[model samples]
Target chain A: MPYGYVNSMKTRPGHRDEVAAILTGGADGLRAAGCRLYVVGLDAADDVTIWVSEVWESKDHHDASLRLPETRAAITRAMPLLTGEFSSRETIIAGGLGVTAG
Target chain B: MPYGYVNSMKTRPGHRDEVAAILTGGADGLRAAGCRLYVVGLDAADDVTIWVSEVWESKDHHDASLRLPETRAAITRAMPLLTGEFSSRETIIAGGLGVTAG
Candidate 1:
């Protein structure tokens, strides 16, 4: 089954741009690690927030991505900019454009 | 450009199933109106919450979707079950799976 994660995070005021950069810059790396989707978005209501929607080949791949040294490095760079973790939702992809139904 | 929206919501206790049903049940209608992605997700932290990730052909298409009769009906049916609107982020799809970059 395809695994997915949907989440939003709030950074300190003025850190949104930095966070977006980090997230996007890390995209190719994530994709190389079997991430099918890594969408980076700007919150419409709050300028300091960002959203991420990701789909991975499997839940195992999603978990394994975190252990990659490059990912860990990116996380370290981004950790300081975050003010709070807003919310996260995990799902099993049923079927859609980017994913195949299992 | 491909337009996207990522958001998560909290429903009144015990209302998640109803909300997911309404959202997914209306998927075909949304697709008919040019919606390319409509991912429904359940929150990991809160059982009563849900997440939605949507992609439309254009920002106009996304806006026009709200005016669709079926879309309006679904929204009306869902409004009562919601407890809070948590977050919404709007994005220009740069490039990724499921979308072609312009």
Candidate 2:
């Protein structure tokens, strides 16, 4: 099974556009790094909360993408626009799951 | 700003209840580690997809919780019932974001 990661973060008020731009600019980099699926969704009621779902071929591939200069730069640019601290966890894919196949 | 983490994973078919049990069993461990808000929400249309949102006092606290034996055991028990791979990213909290006080 392919490894995947879900990253959710809340943007500072009025900074949603800036945050979205940062994410969009780095989409290619993520795709080039073997990201099969990448999506950014906003909370229906609160525009500031953004959730990102990404699927990579493997954890190594995902790690490699993070080391890319472009990815690093994009995150750096987004730092100031983050409203609350973000956290994440690494999980192993153990059957019976599927996506829409992007 | 409070550091929060969202961990999303998909359960094996017909394993939604099991997944929730695992999560519930570990709730105390998370809360004891300074997790202010911990919620497990299943996708509206898909019961297999589960999303967990937790707010911790800091990343260190979150990290500490992960290192605990209970947390490790809980995850290990849930591994076999996992359907798809999970992914996560760490982001810094850099203003204007608020959550409903718990």
Candidate 3:
């Protein structure tokens, strides 16, 4: 089954965009690292929250991704702008439209 | 800009699979209704929660889908299996991998 992760983070005031940019900047590397989907989103109803939704080939792939140079760098850049208040969930991609475990 | 919605719902004990089935059953129709992506995910660490991630061409398209016959029927079938516990976020698709507003 494809591993999924959905998370929301609160950025420091006025830093939401910066965090989002940093997150998306690493998308290219992620695709080659077994990521099937990697989305950076800005909360429509709030200015300080950013959401990231991801689907990976497996849990191991997701864990390995965090150690990649680009991924590590992106996390470093985004961390400073974040408030540390976050919520996340790890999921198993059962089945759905526009995506397949393959 | 594309509209994004990520939500989690708790299913009554032992009803997670049933609820997930109901949610994904309408996937075929969602694509025709302007849904770019619709994912039904089962919590990896929990058995009773299901997460749904979606990207729509526009908020209007998403709203209109709620009125579709299949959608309504699916919701009705799934409601009885849910526990009424939910968490959701509405977002703007800033940028990402494997997805585009168009």
**Would you list the C-alpha lDDT of every candidate in the order shown?**
0.77, 0.62, 0.88
Using TM-score, give the best candidate's number. 3
Ordered list by DockQ, greatest first: 3, 1, 2
Docking quality category of candidate 1 according to DockQ thresholds: acceptable
Indicate whether candidate 1 or candidate 2 has the larger lDDT: 1
**lDDT at A28 for candidate 2?**
64
The candidates, ranked best first by TM-score, are 3, 1, 2
User: What's the TM-score of every candidate structure?
Assistant: 0.72, 0.49, 0.96
On a 0 to 1 TM-score scale, where does candidate 1 land against the true structure?
Answer: 0.72
The best candidate by DockQ is 3
lDDT of 2 by residue, A4-59 (tens): 56566788899976886677556666767877545454444466877654566777
- Output candidate 1 Cα RMSD: 3.6
Task: Write down the C-alpha DockQ for each prediction.
Answer: 0.33, 0.04, 0.79
lDDT of 1 by residue, A1-102 (tens): 678898778898888888877887776788789888777766666678777788889889999999999989988999999986687768866554434535
The residue ranges of model 2 lying beyond 4 angstroms of the native Cα positions read: A89-102, B1-102
Q: By summed lDDT, which 10 consecutive residues of candidate 1 chain A come out lowest?
A: A93-102
Which wins on lDDT, candidate 1 or candidate 3?
A: 3
Candidate 1, B15-101: lDDT as tens digits: 888887788787677788888778776665667877778888888998998998888998899999998667777876545444453
A102 in model 1: Cα distance from truth in Å? 2.3
lDDT of 1 at B83: 80
Q: How much is the lDDT of residue A3 in candidate 1? A: 83
